[model samples]
Target: MVYTMLDKATLLPDLLRRLDKLPQGHALDLRTYKRNRSVLIRRIGADAFDVTEDGFQKERFQVPFSGLKKLLKVLFKREFPRSTKIRLYALGAADGDDLPTGRKVI
Candidate 1:
């Protein structure tokens, strides 16, 4: 398979546009990997998200949600590769006290 480097400058705008359409409580689960390591990003809000190592919930932590342009720039520079395939999921609103199953958005 061929791997292409993702252009953060161009990708950020489209990503932000999509995120804006989601409901307030929706979440996006981003999964990326390279060789033997993987990273997970659970974007829970338009301006906020949580990061974890290899999908381990126990290792998750909240990350400040800046604008999409800035966030993507940072992610591209520091974390994901151009070929990283991010699987986005839209989580439904939880009931009074329960976690919701995420539905695939794309």
Candidate 2:
């Protein structure tokens, strides 16, 4: 059956309540360039939290958006487990050679 706008609207309050119960880090980082393309949540750091959505669902330590769901499943409900990896891409030459684009990593 098709869902009505009213249905989603009714669900919004509960969704917001669930979101609020999450840790500050669990708030989706809409500020990130990569996440601008989709609707997703993001966990910023390693921390455990008790999240209650609506009145029926209660989850702990939920993570946010991931390019790969595998990472989310494995890392679910845990703060920064071990070390967090960071990735960076730079401009290359037209021939895909390592060009001196003058970009450097800190």
Candidate 3:
């Protein structure tokens, strides 16, 4: 498969779409490089997410899927806002991934 890069402008929205399709209890972690601030979003219910934010302040709360967007804005825009553009550090489950294309495991 070809590699496609996503910018901040597109990353968040694409992430939301993937989150919407994720199975319950699965988590998607979003982190920034500056302060190592990251938000862990876990699908706890059909319409809710269990969120935890860290870096500037540590807090945890549950919100509807739509609320996840607002929460991200608050943290990334208000709390630890960055002045320059950079990549979104997502997909924690793939940390140090090694498998290449067309490889499947059962």
Candidate 4:
């Protein structure tokens, strides 16, 4: 699922909680900020890891709870939504006057 920056803020807690429940075998992929983020969990026996982006742009490591918390605190410095700009495009409108989008006001 693609998430806007705002969506990420709301969803992060839930994601973290879910990760807490997963054993050392299950895997998950998480994208945070506008920056590309992905992780793979390979059960090489019985251990967990924190994977990062390629190109040495980011670093991944094995993390305990404290390490995870610290990583989160440091990595979240960038404000994704604030930095990214989105242009909404509409294909057609009934009147053809303006592109229609967003929720209807009731």
Candidate 5:
């Protein structure tokens, strides 16, 4: 799901809700060029996940999936607003296999 600020403003809540149902191992990768950062969220358990960020010293943090809701809210409210450029990519297993690369969502 390549979400822009506009998409986040309008569909963030719904998106998060759906994400909560995703099976373990699902991942969300967020890219921000302006901030020169990339964040990876990988599900480790039903409600547990790990977050990895690129920076001076690549850091990894663990938080419940619920925490992502707050994180997204903060990003939408304070960091990415209006036209701030951002891209989010979602990946998960499909029948024990990775989703096809050529499959288009829309």
Candidate 6:
């Protein structure tokens, strides 16, 4: 598999778009550069997801599709502030299995 490196400017939107296209029964794990703070997003419904944060609070909550973007922005700012690198992994996923996934790095 090939991985595309994302600079600070494009990482946010790219990650948001990728996460939006995630298929059902799939989960995406995102970790900071040092693997210090992480977030787990599990799709549970067409407009719902279980978001788990392994940061200071270690909290988990359900966020709707409408709020995903905002939530991501907040999480990124809070957990990934000043981070120069980020790692993302999609669990139980295959390359080229989905249209968006096929075109984007995963």
TM-score of 1: 0.46
Give TM-scores for every candidate, taking all chains together and pairing residue i with residue i: 0.46, 0.22, 0.67, 0.46, 0.58, 0.74
Local accuracy of candidate 6 as per-residue lDDT tens digits, 1-106: 2233456567778877776887865677777666667777778777788787777557778988788888878887888789777777667453323312211332
Instruction: Indicate whether candidate 3 or candidate 5 has the larger TM-score.
Output: 3
Clashes of each: 2, 5, 0, 0, 0, 0
Q: Write the per-residue lDDT of candidate 2 for residues 1-106, one digit (tens) a residue.
A: 1111213223334434434454443332111122111122323333432221211122333434222244333322232222222111211112212221222223
Clashing pairs in 5: none
Candidate 3 is scored at a TM of 0.67
- How well is each residue in 5-98 modelled by candidate 5, as lDDT tens digits? 3254455666576568867877765555354455566777888877665533356677887687776565445434444555566666422235
Report the alpha-carbon TM-score of model 6 versus the true structure.
Answer: 0.74
Candidate 3, residues 1-106, lDDT tens digits: the string is: 1222346666667878878897775666565534356666777789998777766787888899878887777766744475344323333332213211121222
Tens-digit lDDT string for candidate 4 (44-104): 2233444343222455557664456555544444323342332111121122123222222
Residue 58 error, candidate 4, Å: 2.8
For candidate 4, the C-alpha RMSD (Å) to the true structure equals 13.8
Q: Which candidate has the highest lDDT of all?
A: 6
Q: Report lDDT per candidate.
A: 0.45, 0.27, 0.60, 0.38, 0.58, 0.68
C-alpha positional error of residue 28 in candidate 2 after TM-score superposition, expressed in Å:
8.2
